[model samples]
Structures are given as C-alpha cells and as structure tokens.
Target: MADIAVSTRGLVKIYSNTVKALDGVSINVNHGEIFAVLGPNGAGKTTLMRILTTQLRPTSGEAYVLGYNVVSDGDKVRRFIGYVPQEFSVWTDLSGYENLLIYAKIYGVPRHEINERINEVLRFMDLSDASKRLVRTYSGGMIRRLEIATALLIEPEILFLDEPTIGLDPAARKMVWDKLTALNKELGLTIFFNSHYMDEVEMYADRLVILNKGKVVVEGAADELKRSVGGEVVELTVDDMSKTVHRVNEMNSLGIRDVNIDNDRGIVRVIVDNAEEALPVIITTLRDAGVRIIKASISRPTLDDVFLKYVGGKISEEGRLQEVRTLRSVIKKG
Candidate 1:
C-alpha cells in the first residue's frame, strides 16, 4: 500500500440516471511513476479525474490517493494532490505572478513563504521572466506552464493533468513535456494524466489505461500494449482494393493476422506475424490476383494501433476541435 500512489476499485459514476460515465473501473498507479488515462470523447476520462481530484464523487466504489480516501477524506487528499484541468483555468486578465498569488492564497501557503514559493515555481517552470506579464499576453504553452506552476504552489505529492499538451504546436508540446519529465525525475512526483495524444502517451507514460464507454479496455506499458497487437502493419495502396482485400483474406497460410481497408484512400492494411517474411508473399498474392500495387510500406505497430485494436477507432479522429479552437483564440490575443 505504501508503494501505491493511487488506487481505485470498482469505481462508477452515473449522471442523470441514464448515463453511466464510469462503470466498474479499477486501476493502480505506482508511486513516483507517470500514469496516463486515455479514451475517446465521453469515455469518462474527465469524470474519473474529477472524482480523484475530489471535485466529483464516485457513484460507487473507492479511490485512494496517497493513503487518503478521495471521498471520505477529500480534504486530506486535496492537500497532497494538485490538478490541472482540460480548460484554461488561469486568469488571463491578471499577470502570471498575480495568478500564482491567488492560487497560493487558495491553497493556504504560509504568508511568509508565499512569495518565495511563487518565485521558485516560476523559475522551475521557466516562467520567471514572464511572471509579471498578463497571462493573456503569454503563448498557449506559457499559459499552460503557468497553470502547472499554480498547481505546484502547494508542493503536492501527486499531480493530475487532463490533456496537458493539447492545441500546442510540436515545439510547445515538447517544451511542456520536457518540463514534466524533469519534474518527474527531480521531484519524484507521481504524475497521472489524461491525454488524447497517443504518441505523447507512448513517449512519456510509464503505464496507461484505455477507457471506452465508461469501462477499462486495456492497461499496460505502451510497449507491452503495442506488443499485444502482435504484428507488423503492411500499409499499401493497390489499384484494386476490394480484390486485394479479398485475395489476402482468402489465403489461409499467409500468416496474416488482420486486415483493414481505408475506403477513402483506397489503401489496404495487412497485419502479419512478421512483415519482412510476409511482405513478399503479400505482394505476390496481390499480383497473382491481378491487383496493381501503387505503394507499400511496413512499420511496427504503434500505440494508435494498440488503441484501435481495443477501442474500435483512433482517438485522434474523435472530439477536441472546439477546445483547440478556444485555446487558439486565446493565443491569438497574446
């Protein structure tokens, strides 16, 4: 129990008697490790985060953070945990230092230590120079770092983030992640987060759980999850997609693992036990069936592939457009 930073058992959340936001979800996050929660829109990612952060109560079951029950000991839990939500929660009208001051007051940081703590987090998050600037003038990534700085004012043991790098460009995302990685390494903070970006999750998370329709679909390290998919992906565009799919599916001894079609692009994706050994056989099979191969490529399964295998679709194809637009609107004014 001492090694576990957070644990949940049979957690459930229901809204309005009709929607079950979480259904019997259970997971364990080890101390000082980076954990990720992944899901499509309406998959209860936020609902779970709200519960763990003591913002929302679970309809059933239990969640424990750092030995404190989130529901019964909400205050104690709050003292040891910090949360950054999906939306821009900072005050854009105020300077970054002012925002931190307000959060410091809310978190009840000692009066004598408030300024020092603010300066420390500002420097730690690389925001010291921008500390006096109104948050509206900061870039999207800077605003996000400020939000993180606000959370860190409490010096909590665990940090929870929902969509930590959403809407930022690649460089901004990289910067945010670099800081987070440093936090994990330097402070040994248990970082639990929800993200729609599978690549980032694969890159940073120590372990992850994929939730869909309020249930846990799969949970493991990214590499373990990808290995579970058990094959290399052979993506090719053929002149005759329908025929290629048919030919590949009809061959039983081809050691093929799965087949899928991209109707819009006319690409047929074949999964096999080994691409190096199977690519030639696949090309030969297609050619004999009078299918013209326009292009072909082979790659190892990715986290997206692991997600689609279990969740039925790529999370990238799901919602989050409006959130990005809102953040972009904020950044445009900066």
Candidate 2:
C-alpha cells in the first residue's frame, strides 16, 4: 500500500560523545498495518524508537511520522502518535480514574466531554470496575492495559509500544497481546513495536523487521520466511564422529549441498535438498559404518535460522563469548 505512514531516510543518531546509536537506518511502515522491529539488547531499537517519538533528535538525516518532520513539527506529531515506553509510566500512587482525569486536564479535553471520554476509555480498558482502586493495587497486566488506554485518549493515528509485554507472566503477556490485536483489527490503529520475543512477533505482527547491531537484517511475514528454506536441516548426534563423517560422505551422491561437523558435541549437521527423500540412504549409510547414534532430528527452517542466515555464521555470538569469559573467571576465582 502506498499509504506510507512512517518513513525514515538515512536516519542516524550519535551520542553526546559521538557514540553512534542508529547508523543510517531507513524503514517505511504503511498505514493501518502492524509492523514489528526485532533485535537484541542495545541493538538500537529503543534509540530508533526514541527518535520517532521525538524524545531524541537524530544526528543526521530525516524522519517523518504522519507526513510531518519529527524535529520541526514534534508537537503536531505527538498529537497524532501515542508511545508507551518499556517502563511503567502511570502514577502508581493515584487511582485509575484519578490519573485519567488529570491527563484529561493536561491534554485540555473539552470540559463537558471529559467525563464522557474518561468513562468510555475506562470501560474500554476493562478498568471501570477498578476505576477508584489505587494503581499500587492493580496487577502488572492491568496497569499496562490502563497505560494503553491513556495512550488512546487523544485518538492517536499511530501507537508505538517498546517491549510492551515485558516483565509480565506468560498469561499476562498473552492478554496484553490479545488486546493489542483487537485494537489493530477493529480500530485499524497502525501499531509499531520492538520486542525480543519471537513468538510474540509471530502472533501479533502482520510484518516484521529484524535488526542486528543497528541495521535491518531481513523483513517479511513470519510464515513466508519460515517456509522459504531451500533445503532441510538434519542434526545427528553420534558417538564416533570420525566413523559417521566417513559414512555421511557417501551420501554426497544423494544431492547434498554441505555436511558440517559439530566436533564439540560429536555431532554432524547435514543439509540436503530434500531431507525426507534422503533419509533412508542417510540412515543406511550410518548403520553400515557401525557408528552409534545418540540422537537425530529433522526440522524446517525457523526464525532463528533466518536470523543466523542473514546475520552471519555467528549470530549474537558476542554475548555468548562474554558469558564464557565470565564463567571462566568465576571458576578461576572459586
């Protein structure tokens, strides 16, 4: 759809000391569609979000939300957009109704319609029953629902949620997800968000973009990308890799692309054109080699594989290395 709702061209942001947070990131989100940005911690997802919400200015390039420059017309942009940060923002010391009433006054809602609007939003958020209850008594999920309700007070054209379901239990996360889905489907609010949870994005987003170290690695629908693997992945664990490797080499006649060794685990990963058809030959070869098989599994490509495919051989390997170094130090100290 040519209805471009959010557009950024060469968007770059550097810190006060010139540490680049966003590096020439450009993306377009269509109107009335759900778009998700996926990344690990410190991958610049929050930084990009802050720039869009007008909390931080970009160091270079331009960003537009609802056809207005984020820097020049920030007030106008804020009027049409609602942002829910990762942290809990609602005043915990006040009652549900009290917070909304105060926000109504701050936003300058019409004096006569304030009551009607407040009541309508409270009911929609399922907080009408707890309207008078102090926020300290509300559950985490309820508070998040109330936060979303407040964001909707201005009838925003777009909603940006950053890790919206973080810190909630599984059931609470699902409830938040269901409510978000309802808003997107019934009201057609253009939802934009970032989350580390893959399953959540798979469920709620119509489209997704994965970012690694400040750049989009891939962008597309969940199902399409999951099913796009050109070959099957077979993971085999063996007691004697040397024997297994020799036998697996015989299957090269079966149209195999590559056979990789997992020396640490005494396993092998075989990638073939048609995994199902080659299974009999593969099994026959392994049995003939007198190798003991520990475990074997076949799987279609997943979002994890997609991430590794585009990102590189070692996706998020930096964190793993850090953990290894930390563990080594702990062991040495002990």
Candidate 3:
C-alpha cells in the first residue's frame, strides 16, 4: 500500500431516485504513473474521481489516497491531491494571475510563498506569458492550462483531472498531454484522468480501466488489452454491409472470432485469427456473393476495438455537447 498512490474497493455512489453513479468499483493507481478512466459520458468516471478526491462520498466501500482513507482523512487527502473538475473552474472575468491567486488562497497556500508557487505553476504550464490576460480572452487550451496551474498551486502528490482535454483541437490536445507527461516525469506526480478519447488513452495511459453503466468493464495496459481481443482486424466498407456479413459467416475455415458492423459508415469489421490467411478468403467470398467492397484494410486491433469488444459499441458523445459549445465560445475570442 505504501507504493500505491490511490486505491478503491467496492466503491458505490447512489444519487436520488436510485441512480447508481458507481457500482462496486475497485482500482489501484501506482505512484508516478499516468492512469486513465475511459467510458462514454455518465459512466461514473466523475463519481469515482469525486469519491477519491473527497468532493463526494461513496455510499459504501472504501477509497484511499496516499495511504489515507478518503472519508476519514479528507483534509489529508486534499493536501496530497490536486483536482480539476469537469466543469469550467476558472473565473473568466479575472486575469489568469488573479485566478491563480484566488485558488492559492482557497487552498491555503502560505502568504509568503504564494507568489512563488503561482509563478512556478504558470511557468510549468507554459502560461506565464498569458498570466495577465483575462481568462475569457484566452484560447480554450490556455484556459485549460490555467485550470491545471491552479490545481498545481498546492504542489499535490497526485493530480486528478476529469476530461482535461475534452474539447481542444488536435494540436492543443497534444500540447496539454505533453505538459502532463512532463509533470509525471519531472515531479513524479501520479496522474489519474478520465477521457473518452481512445487514441489519447492508447498513446499516454500506462494503464486504464473502461467503465460502463457504472461498472468496470475491463482494465489493463492498452496493448495487453488489445491483444486480449485475440486477433488482427480486416475492416471492410461494402456497398451491402448486410450481404458482406452474411457471406463472411459462411466461410468457416477463416476462423473469424467476431464481426462488428458500423452501420453508420457501411463498414464490416471482422476479427480473425490471422488477417493474412483470412483476408483472401473473405474478399473472394464477398466478391462471389456480388458484395462490392468499396474499401478494405488489415491492421492490428486498436483500443477502439478493445472498447467495442467490452462495451458492445463505439464510444458516444451523448453528454459532452455542452462542453463542446463552451469550448467553442472560449476559442472564438482567440
């Protein structure tokens, strides 16, 4: 337990009307590693983070941070952890420096050291140049960095971020992750963040758990999880997806493990023991059936594939439409 930064067992949170935000979640986050919680919105990612950060209490089960129980040692837990909630946290009316100062005060940073801490975090987050600019005037990425800067003012051992890069552009998202990677390497800070971005999780997370309907679906290293799906994928876009699927099923020698259809894209993604052996057979079978293949490619399974295998569908953007709007508003000013 000494080396473990965060741990939870059988954690549960129930809202009014018997909505279970989290159900029997248990996980361990090692010190000095980047961990990710991934799921579609309302999957209880925020609930679990809130419980560990002491922002909300679990109805049952246990959660600990830095060897201290979150319930019994909320203050101690708060001292050792920095949290950036999913909603907008900074005051858009205020300059970035003023925003940090307010948080430094709220977090009880000593008066004498507050300025130095603010400067340090601003520099670390690469927001020193925009320190005097109003948050409303900054780009979406700048505001996000400032929020992270505020979280760091306390110099916590672990950082908890809820969808830290949710609505940023590709370059902006990469920049944010670059900063986080540096934080983990340079400060040995444990980072636990929730995201719906499969590619980001695949690239950055040392380990991750996928939650669905308030329960953990699967957890492990991304590559290991992908391999667990047990096959390469031969993805095809055909004029008649239904016909292609029907044709593929008749080829028993291909040893196809599973077939997933993206009806929206007219794609049939087949998991097979060997794409090299199965591709030719699948193509010929489809051609003989008069199913026109518009596109086809063979590639190793990805985190998305792993997600589909476990969660039974692709990740959805159902609950994040508002966040997207807010991000657009912030970016419009810049």
Measured against the true structure, the TM-scores of the candidates, in listed sequence, are 0.90, 0.84, 0.89
lDDT of 3 by residue, 8-120 (tens): 99998986525667889999888888999999877889889999999888999999999999999998888888889888999999999999999999999999999999999
**Candidate 1 lDDT score at position 200:** 92
Candidate numbers, best lDDT first, in rank order? 1, 3, 2
Writing each residue's lDDT as its tens digit, candidate 2 over 76-153 gives 898888889999879999999888888878877889998898898888778899999999999999999999888888
Residue pairs in candidate 2 whose N, alpha carbon or C atoms collide under 3 angstroms: none
Give the winner by TM-score.
1
Tens-place lDDT per residue, model 1, 1-334, is 4999999999999765546678999999999999999887777899999999999999999999998999899999999888999999999999999999999998999999999999999999999999999999999999999999999999989999999998999999999999999999999999999987889999999999998877899999998998888779999998888788888999788688888775545678788888888889889888888888999999899887787678655343443454345445666666
Each model's lDDT comes to 0.88, 0.81, 0.88
Candidate 3 contains a number of clashing pairs equal to 0
* Candidate 3 Cα lDDT to native: 0.88
| Decoy 1 TM-score against native | 0.90
Higher-scoring candidate on lDDT, 2 or 3: 3
Over the full model, what C-alpha lDDT does candidate 1 score relative to the true structure? 0.88
